[model samples]
Target: MDTARENRTWGALSDLPGHPMMWVLILTETVTFGLLFAIFAITGVVHSDVFSAGRAQLDPVLGGVNTLVLITSGWLAALAVEARVIGRRTIARLLLAGAAALGCVFTAIKVVEYATKVSVGIGLETDTFFTLYFLATGFHLLHVILGVIIIAAVAMYDSLDNLKTGTAFWHMVDLVWVVMYPLIYLVG
Candidate 1:
């Protein structure tokens, strides 16, 4: 009975999308971000005034634009995976390029957002809200940069499995940002 259960577990894992290891990364990242999000929420309630002021300072328009950019990038990444599965290597590469380009745009917008904050002297020490804001968004920005690099590498390599794995990472990055935008930008 134990052997049967073990085999069932392994079989379920094997049927997951992308590389099994990539799912591991997705699960790990999701848990980490979830913890940060909960902390941010609890801290917001504890320091409601600080969080409100911090949210007011942020540019929701820019955050909305970034959200759209990431969503579209995720779509392109998905398309690239589909194209790869269909043996359309060139199309898949093009799709990946589009995805990576959007990733670059997202990164650029985030840098601009950070620069705007810094120009006004709003560093991480500004308050509890700013501290969590910088830490969470900065960590997410790092993932975007890494996702772009991985997408480019996958495009060059152009294997179906590699494309699926790399795009899966990209989608994970996108998912984080989608959840984060409203929480960090609009929640009050």
Candidate 2:
């Protein structure tokens, strides 16, 4: 009887499938972001005034909009995961598409912001603060682009099983943006 129960549990687990490797990928990404936060903290301590002044140059409107976009995408991703769990495949796909489109919008806005900064003579080589700002924001943008691509691919393939994992990653991205948006754009 115990053997039969164990078999049943294994079977159930197998039936509910998502990529096992996603957990490891997410953990590694979390560690990477943690290290980045640590570096930002250290830099802020050493160059508080410069960082503050540099932060002032950033356009708060753009940053806020980007933050909203990321947050909205995260919400959509969560909805997609929920829809998949409830067996609402069409809703799941629609939510995933919305998330992906929002991600694209986020990227476009970031590009515009970057272009404006460059035109105004603020870039990585401009100053320490700009360097840190570009490094942090640029890295985050890359992650956003990659996440969009991944979500688009999954949607194209009609695979909602991994929506939960994607949503988890999207939430992390949104959370990071929340912290970063205020730090880089609002606080003086």
**Residue 151, model 2: Cα distance from true site in angstroms:** 0.7
- Could you tell me the C-alpha RMSD of candidate 1 in Å? 2.9
Residue-wise C-alpha lDDT for candidate 1, range 8-112, written one tens digit per residue: 665655677778788888889999999999999999999999899999999999999999999999999999898989898999999999999999999999999
Q: Which stretches of candidate 2 lie over 4 Å from their true place?
A: 1-18
Q: lDDT per prediction?
A: 0.93, 0.80
Candidate 1 overall lDDT versus native: 0.93
Clashes of each: 0, 0
